[model samples]
Target: MASTMSRLMLGRTLERICKAVLLLCLVHFLIMMILYFDVYSQRFDIFSRFNNGRGANASRGPHHYYYNYSRPNTTFPSYLPGADQLLPTAKPEANRTRPTPKPIPPCPEVPPGLVGRLLIEFSSQMTMERVQRENPNVTEGGKYTPTDCRPKQKVAIIIPFRHRDHHLKYWLHYLHPILRRQKIDYGIYIINQLGEDTFNRAKLLNVGYTEALKDAEYDCFIFSDVDLIPMDDRNLYHCYDQPRHFAIAMDKFGFRLPYAGYFGGVSGLSKKQFLKINGFPNEYWGWGGEDDDIYNRITLNGMKVSRPDVRIGRYRMIKHERDKHNEPNPQRFNKIQNTKNTMRKDGISSLTYRLASVKKYPLYTNISVEIGKPPPRPIKG
Candidate 1:
């Protein structure tokens, strides 16, 4: 009986110890599961906030949120649990377009540097080299634009030139400063007739218009006599709605216009205005008739000569003897009478010439061409 009692007590003690151990393990497992769930909740909350922030930034534009999180330098620890799955993958930027730049505004009408009524002087010692040194801003081919502002117009000053280097020196000396003051984006073109054949001033002017366009899209063409120089800086070298007559009162004609219809000296015409008149008549081979013929063409196209007041339009003509081959054309009167009939067919459309050479100098671009001699007189029966 004593032995049976001892065995039963021993079995009861062993069962109690086993029950305690089981209870402890259950409590530990419950705590571990709670801690794990808490950690997962915090991680999920952080990931949600990150996703929400990215979503908020999406409305702002791609540039705001674009970043290279997966670059080659980025490293992840393989030891960490689920390190590869920590964040959502980023998408590639789609359909990106660069912003367009704004256009530059046109320059002001009257430039700040303008000082009206410039002092005019001429000297015998002035040379091309000296003129070039004075106008260092003028680039090769005589191009210049104001550095401070965009120019109001692109002007091409076309001088029908031949044997007049001395006159040209005076012109370059005075005109370069004046043009800069006026804030003109301009180029100087000397259209030279190659052979000693009668100088076709009008044809050479047309050649200037065509050749200048080859270099730049010049909207305004100022056909000028090489000898004439403006006395005022305010006589701006730009285009207007009407054809501009810059040298309205030249000193050669006693500072007065010789006639009501005189369109000689310096004139400015827009590209459109020139094309509308079919350009100056090519048939006027000599000095006397071309200007008048051009005036008639202007009127026939219903355009008038625009000019500033005499005070601002003043000019001084450099005196020189007439060129040998540029004598008065005896047929000038007859050609002037028939301007309307010949204008359309005999202007720029019917023009032809062979270029001898094109040279760019420091102060000007010289274009020499062989405009064929005057059409031989019709053989009389």
Candidate 2:
């Protein structure tokens, strides 16, 4: 009888062990599945409906269409600046010859001519799903061009980005329609700073110019801030007779040009025009100096900012707190002070960066570039 009981106990023990092993294997499989989905597409399981996501928030109201995480808002140090491993590439069909564009006003007029700046309303919150649903015609990669007419000029609109995912959704929601209306053959680019270092606005713009050209021939380049939305479509996106400053007036500055040299918001240049200035200076480490430096580069290149009358170039800046690392550069005025002296030697001709990844998302060509910290300027006497 005692032998029988001992055998029975041993059998129970083996069964328990088998069950535990089975449980562990199931857990491992579940974990791997979660990670794979997160990395590949970021789409969530049914449980995602409960997560509201991060950064900005919004209720599913009348504007509801779809919902998904745009991107992680976790702050990261600047990516270690490295040389680009891969040059930009065109999509498989990018080289296909397009139909020649019809005349500029290929579509119907909306109120006829530039009726001055129209006031626009921006929602307090935005969503990746909403943008996708509304712009169904935008295709998988945030690219759109009028099919009916061959555009007059091809443009690359570049936005330097960091931790502002919601702002980007809004930009797409508005700009896609506006660009289509303007009849521009354009591709949207969001050049994202990859590291947790201080945001280098100018360097990102330089990378945009390089990567955009590498992918295709875009003769006109528009360097735009993500937060600003245009109030007027009349601020034609096509290249002008000279470099055009698109955001001449902003509601932030009372819809007026802030100052004579204020070129911070939105500006444009043809390929030859951008090359003439040798591109923007790569050394403006923080926010304040780059715009002024660009203006100086323009001036040094024997060019001037050809702005539309304030009424035609109206913009509304989406409000947000300044980023922690983007504190106003006390040295900005000094940087501007030396634009002419340093521009010839320090602009795009001297630019260097490593391309970490170039992802073509449904909405834009996201070029992840790693730029190094700029060398400190020698203390001026």
Candidate 3:
């Protein structure tokens, strides 16, 4: 009875051992299958090892890739047997359509006899002493002829600037052509500070608005930066009925806005509209806060800001060295919080700046204004 019991125990132990061994083998097989053919295993790009053996060279046949790059055959494929042969043959010479050049419009045709006399008369009438005199077409008191001198719409290209010469050059080169084509009779006024204190970007902008209107009646003002260049000719600097954000999708932010309420780089506002909002806050000295403060001013005064489409509002930035005293102002946030109260007191009406010089060339004019100094530190209580 003892021997029989031992035999039964031994048999049961062997059966359990065999089952455990089989399960181990099955688990190993499943792991191998997962590493080889699982859906996610194929997509695993991390830590993948490439075969460095000589046999792997056989798979990359030289002729297989070389033949793919050869020039394509001119003849049609074998499936379309007669397609090439059925095509019409070219003639040696053919009649081509040559476009006719547009005829230049002739100069206003006056009678030949009066041309010389009219020139002498015009010259005599345009003397400095008789500048206030009027011809038949001119209004009795007006010196300028109604038709001869088209009334120049006063436009001020107000640039908020610091030390950015290279970027400024690119802006000037590109924008001069654009403004001239617009034919609004504009002036480019870069309100540069005399010395390097904390860079007051918004104050310079307000200075531009206040000073630009002092010399002439500037109906429209463009608040632009030196770095941003308009990608399309359609970006008119002139404002519409509402405030216009010119630089909408810049390459700096991957041709898309980082977030909503982004008002940076180029923007435009009419004189009346700008004054109504008391102009931009002077406290945002460094890089940030000015844009957001302006946006707040627009919304609080019951004005909506409009922007150009992403495609049309594209701009290119000129990469260059950073400016002195124009480092990112760390206290921009504190000042931005108090913008509403401060802007009313320190803005356009209370603003003060001096004219450095004014020069009028044949094509356009240049007006330099000494904004004098930046405001006290925004951090100080």
Top candidate (lDDT): 1
lDDT per model, in order? 0.86, 0.77, 0.63
Name the regions of candidate 3 deviating beyond 4 angstroms: 1-153, 359-381
Q: Which of candidates 1 and 2 is the stronger one according to lDDT?
A: 1
Per residue, candidate 2 scores C-alpha lDDT tens digits across 305-372 of 79887777889888999986777777778888898888888878998899999888877888888897
Candidate 2, after superposition: displacement of residue 26 in Å? 99
What is the full ranking by lDDT, best candidate first? 1, 2, 3
Candidate 1 TM-score versus the reference: 0.72
Worst lDDT window (10 residues) for model 1? 58-67
Each model's TM-score, in the order given? 0.72, 0.68, 0.56
Runs in model 2 lying further than 4 Å from the true structure:
1-119, 376-381
Whole-model lDDT for model 3 versus the true structure? 0.63
Q: Which candidate is the best by TM-score?
A: 1
Question: What tens-digit string does per-residue lDDT give for candidate 1 at 59-119?
Answer: 3322221245568886654443443333444444574466897766677877778888877
Error of 1 at 193 (Å): 0.6
Tell me the lDDT of model 3 at 182.
41
Clashing pairs in 1: none
- In order of TM-score, best first, we have 1, 2, 3
